[model samples]
Target: MIFESSETSGFPVATPRAVPPSGRRPGWNKVPEVTVYFWTIKILCTTVGDTAADLLKEKAGLGLTGVSVLMSTVLAVVLAAQFRSTQYRAGVYWPTVALVSVVGTLAGDNLIDATGVTVETASSVFVIALAIVFVVWYRRERTLSIHSIDTTSRESFYWLAVLFAFALGTAAGDLVSQRLHLGYWLSAVLFGLAIAAVGLAHFQLDLDAVWSFWTVYILTRPLGASIGDYLSRPSGDGGLELGTVVTSALFLMVIVGLVVYLAATRVDVTDPEHTSRHVA
Candidate 1:
């Protein structure tokens, strides 16, 4: 997250730099390779995470803090297993994502409801933290491409960034809907459009891959949360009245099906040759 300010022939130049080098290595990709399927399942997981957490908190009688801790502990275990595996195993990777998504959402909830932090302040803090993580990650690894996530350190940074994005998204989403009173459906639509804008910028406007990935990452959290709220909240709360348990179960099934398919087929495996071409 270190910003480099230097004089280039007496002209000031500002360069954003990561602290850790990008850890360009040859092996299973550290970050999940991006694909339409990747995005599709990610949003699904986020929704599941949101609804499931809510159900656990309300129906299961675990308060917000208790549920957050439980999910965070589970996420840590899953992530540890994910890191231990040598290859990009979809089975390990996506479950870790789902657990972390739930934990991350709770983190934001704790910050606002438990601590009374303003959404604006929480969002701003998360942005700064994310920037710092990126700065350190890039400075050590030397690249920020997901295709280069081969080392342990870089993978750690990647997950930290992911965690922050989810938390940030929660706060930002709540800010728009609750504070600004935009309502669930409208907020979901807004974040959806924002995601589209990021895609357009990435594909057509030639945005940097690092920027595109992170931008979309943040947007996805709120988008997923919106979806979760829309499905699980009471009819009085603007949801479809499906209840959290049913919505969570439905999404979990879909996620399991997709993960099993990816694991069996290796559909999302990053092609080493294709990645090398991009680097070259």
Candidate 2:
């Protein structure tokens, strides 16, 4: 199997990596290739995550704690299946992401709505937690590039960082929109602009790709959350009033359709033409 590592490639950095001479791993990278489709499906998953949390709480009467428990169980099962797979499988990977998005949303909610922690305080807490995860991950692995996720430990760190990103996004989104009254559409626009600036910096101003990727990843969560709220919330609340169920169903269907296409085409697989390139 091909082992994609950044020991001698991709955005330059000062840290050293431990790529083997062969650069081939006993197992392939368990994560999907980063592509436009990946980002599209990610935003859809986030939107569904935001709306589904509302549905589970209000429609299903699970409350914040109950939905948290239920989704956490589901996330655990899906993540176990993810860890068992040796290669990137859309069937397993995207489902785990979708479940993670939901659980992450609920986690942020429980901290604020249940524990009376202000969104600002909660957001700050998650920021510190995420920073600690990154420090620990990089200290151990000497690399934070997702392209290097060919080992179980690297994959574990990747998912942990992802969960923290989602939670942080939720708290920050609420703090700005719900607590500060920026409104959903405006919040989405602001985040969209921020991501665009990041892209510009990475491409034109010499920003680091690894940092750019992580920054954009975290920003996408709030963008998706804002979009979901704008579509599902009532007109009285300045939303389009589409309702949570409809919003969730629409995004979920789109995500499923895209995943099916991705699985069939394998278009997102990294370099099918040279899957055996040696790591330098």
Per-structure clash totals for the candidates: 22, 0
Clashing pairs in 2: none
Q: Compared with the true structure, what per-residue lDDT tens digits does model 1 show for residues 1-280? A: 3333321121112233443335446546754557767888889988987887788788757788788878888888999899998868899999988888888888888888899989898888888888898899877776666666778887898889888888888888877887767767888899999988876875687666567667887888888888888888888888888888888999999999999999898767766665444443
Cα-based TM-score, every candidate: 0.88, 0.90
Compute the lDDT of residue 41 as modeled in candidate 1. Answer: 89
Worst 10 residues of 1 by lDDT: 5-14
Scored by Cα lDDT, where does model 1 land? 0.77
Per-model lDDT: 0.77, 0.82
Residue-level error in angstroms, candidate 2, position 257: 0.3
